[model samples]
Target: MKRLMLIGITVAALAGVAAAAPVSVEIATEPGLNVTAPQKWLQLFAEIGQTGVRIRGMRAGERPRLEELGGSRRVVGVLTRRGDLLLPGGKFRQRDRAALADYFDRVAKDGAEGVEAPRGRFDLTEKQFRTAYDALSEPLGFATKDQPPRAVVERVRDRLPIALEIDRAAERTLNNAGPLAEDLEPLTVGAALAVMLARDGLALTPEHPRGGEVRLRVAVAGDVADSWPVGYDPPASPRETAPVLFEFLSVEVEGFTLTEALDAITPRLGGLPVYWDHASIAEAGVDPASTQVRFERKRTYYKRLIDKLVFQARLKSRLRVDEAGTAFLWIGR
Candidate 1:
């Protein structure tokens, strides 16, 4: 009885040791392949495991070997035309194997565009490849809600120049009205304008300089603009400084009349008074309570919102600032 109990203790200790053992993955590389590529691929595997997985790279003529270590887990494989031949460690379950396979496939398809591998394989673009590599190595942990709206808009604006131009034009128009509307941030307004332009299937391409001035050509899905809003002209210049109403806002409405939309946003504008050019609206027969407006939950500026309202109502606005610094809106058809 004593001998049997001692033997059982020994077996239990061995099992514990095996469970705590480290896992390693070995990859064989072809000649002339970038050394860092293999390291990146290994890092991605480590990310999926949520642990530090060891990696070993073998050079050409070194036969790839995968063996079950007495007390450690390991993965062994090589990239091939058919796919990766992955051998998971003893600690890895069937589910883990599936997840690794799926991740590898995604990396190959989306990330590898012009990447050159050892076996004359060139599949991943440099950007795609780098992004894939960083996914495993660099983890972004911030929640989206914690991010500022203006920062988000700036990122989008940098990618689209036409969007920037549109925002500038809107700012100029709002500044012309003076104190009636609040100040506009180019990035925030640009992002909103970009979304609107995309919805209309419109794209703007700036033409080469002609006699010292540049003109923008509008295209709709690769075709010349045959139908667009009439009587639209680009604003002259964007204003640099003005009063700001709200720093950031996310508004969404559909099937709401222009007046109702304004009413809804008025409370959020820090009690800044709004005045409309009643005479111009009345003369043009524009009914503020009848025009429908729709906006999505994107970071927006007050001036950008006003620009949208005026465009939808088929009217123009002028800013009038009094000597007392009070701002008023004058609407014109």
Candidate 2:
């Protein structure tokens, strides 16, 4: 009897602990507009809850604040005045309010907590806004595996008016570039397109803006192809005939911005120095100081770490060697 009572007590205690655990909530909203009515916000909360996000009412004497909403396992959605929807808990932001809400709702129903808020304004042109959204959302839980890039392209093409004329040659080139397996999250048109652009080296341009038509342009790096050729093959991968060695007594980095990260690691890279593109870094909104990286791989190839740093900063890296045998790590777009 005593043993049974102890078992019951332990189960009750575990249940209590589970019940006391904080719930995660993610809020989704349409494009930012001045919300003057508290009821509207409340209604939005109710609607979000109806989608099964398990939103709890604010406690007595508790106030709604963005910073306070962020928790270790919590995700909060908010809209900036620039009409951008952001997930505040170090997650990527997206502009498709419905899809974001659906995603958050799914997460919440899985016993997570999410919060949503509206924040300040920022100036962003249409193109800039689209570019930023595409860049950020590509890494988020927005692209699914098993979805072909060509299918995504077709979907995007269908959304645009029939007036848009897709270059068949460019389309073929992009298709032949192979499957994009970047992120296995959920699939969004924008995210898929970003992957395609990154992988296939193809560009999309709004050619007849007034007429609502877009044009596909094939402008792969180092190539000026007026028309994509059949059975065209990309250049062979560059192999380093000789490897360089670097000696580092020790290296430790924490919360360094891109510049600081570079400064700290470049010295350990032997004579190879990284050339940073300020404009690209600024455009990507990468603050090196905000990023943390640690490396203890002694005598390792510098190119490996340089690639990692650039990837963490949401930029690209290329290695260039001059005729003088000096190696340069080019970082940026």
Candidate 3:
């Protein structure tokens, strides 16, 4: 029903602009597949108008699914030889919207020359990779309610020292993942972003050209096998990085959910933040909210208790440090 309303709006908008605009855009979709909203379509065409294309006529129509159009579902704009652009059904972020306009403008003028294929590899020297990885250690905090991942990433990017780029396909994927709800404690910028992105099956991978600048690329997790980890090993010992976890504390839990155990131990960790591998847990079908766990120790430290709890839940805990040399707990399979 909502989709039908959207399609109606698209056709109406097309009719409203058709006589004035030279270029036409066809909004493509498959049954049960989603596409961009009418407002975004209008905004995209407005941006494209700035590109100075000769206006002719505008129209809206549906083609096959993106797969049938020889494009990935993650792709945004598909320009045809007839100067018509077909956009797959999906939401678009500001960056992606602008990217599409610029892309179409170029293709319309230059006949689709110099378009780069979807990037599959990121080459970086060991030092270059390390340099970018170190930036993840920078301390950061994130709190959002019903915000898209792309917007959250843009906020994070403004505060980070490292260069980060969201691939077009990845941007579409993130936007499609819908609004994110997160309230994370202070972790490194990398860890915070990693946790948020994990929920969408996305990841941040570092890249650098020889003698060039270092940057991090956000791509689908499966697409980039060597993406940055949720957390890295702490530079110092557990006692130094997170002394609270090592402090003596008697603990007992016959059957407590993962969240329950974390609640009891979080404050004791002495400001050590904890993050979960959202993608991994989802794929493994592990629901921390209801995953019952048991760990009893007459006399044990918080670290020991945490280990036992996660192990029972079929998860693991890692002591890692962010770029700021702050300690945090990364729990996942």
Q: RMSD per prediction, one decimal?
A: 24.0, 22.3, 17.1
lDDT of 2 by residue, 1-333 (tens): 957965764564344332222335554443334454223444554555533343332333433233333332454455444434345332333334466456444334322222232211122234433443343333223343455656656555545322223456655775675554434233333333433454455544322121111233334423432222111121333344124422224344456665677776666655554454444565677755576655544544455666666677678776543322334455666
Candidate 1: residue 54 Cα off by (Å): 99
What candidate 2 gets wrong by more than 4 Å, as runs, is 1-146, 160-164, 184-191, 209-294, 297-333
Q: Give the TM-scores of the predictions, in the order they appear.
A: 0.27, 0.26, 0.56
Predicted candidate 3 versus true structure: per-residue lDDT over 1-333, tens digit per residue: 957965764564344321211233444323332234434445666765643222222335624122222221122343333334554433344457667665544333322221232333355435555677677776666565577777778777777676567778888987788775455547677777777888888889886532235677899888886766666687778888888888887777877798888887787666676777777787788998898988755888888888988887788898887666666788888
Q: Write the per-residue lDDT of candidate 1 for residues 72-155, one digit (tens) a residue.
A: 534455543233434322122223556565533332232222112221111333443343223212211222233333342334
What's model 1's lDDT at 101?
A: 51
Could you tell me the lDDT of residue 314 within candidate 3?
86
Output the lDDT of residue 301, model 2.
49
> Residue 60 lDDT in model 1?
57
Give me the candidate number with maximum lDDT: 3
Give lDDT per model, in order: 0.42, 0.44, 0.63
